[model samples]
Target: MKKHEGLNCDDCVEHLYTYLDGELTGETESDVRVHIEGCGDCFGHFEFERTFLRFLEARAKAQCAPEPLRRRIFKEVLLDNGSEAE
Candidate 1:
């Protein structure tokens, strides 16, 4: 990917996650947005990570911990709090 005026593909990739998470300031975010719009390779990488995060979110929502695992977590929390399991 060619280097843009404000950011290159490497800089864009470095800040990709922060950009996706809306953690960047206005100017920095704009720089990343402009770079991705002009750079096909960086844009592809951004899209792939976005899609992968969505897939993981969906999978997490569809699954649940087993009863034994849940109980074990509860017990651990109680122990950490210095409380006996009832």
Candidate 2:
């Protein structure tokens, strides 16, 4: 395995979406996991990113209103846009 110095926070941030979505394949995922485990700075960055993603997920869930409210908003908001009327 490489010494992990060559990779930095930028690299970690860039790959974070892929890592969370499980898009990384064999060796790349292994390398990222190793770097996160060994490097405190990179690990902190990863933790922050992970927590941010979780917060976004929670916010999205919270923003999802009840079905009647969703329907009312959709009809009042989206249906007001006349572009799709044709």
Candidate 3:
């Protein structure tokens, strides 16, 4: 099949995450597929996001935050910010 030359910025940015997550449907999904087939810039962005998510997952598994740290953050930030319920 022939490749597209470029995609409109809106289509590139808007559908990017959805397309990556396989959340797009119908015409929108088709549009993203067509765009990625040819647009190097957008494809690069898609690849980067995928790689980043993989890194985040691996890091979360390798070095999880301690429960005390979570509680401290909640008390210092959330409670300090007055987000507590009455």
Best-matching candidate per lDDT? 1
lDDT against true structure, model 3:
0.80
Q: Report the C-alpha lDDT of model 1 over 1-85, residue by residue, as the tens digit.
A: 5344689889889998999888999778989998999999999999999999889889889878899988887778756557553
Model 2 lDDT tens row, 1-86: 55444456677667877887789987678767877788898788778888998998898887656899889878877886655675
Ranking by lDDT: 1, 3, 2
In terms of TM-score, the best-performing candidate is 1
**Model 1 error, position 81 (Å):** 20
Stretches of candidate 1 exceeding 4 Å from the true structure: 1-4, 63-86
* Model 2 steric clash pairs: none
Clashes in model 1: which pairs? none
Please write out the lDDT profile of model 3 over residues 19-83, one tens digit for every residue. Answer: 87889997678878878777888878889998998888898889778999999999988887785
- Which clashing pairs does model 3 show? none
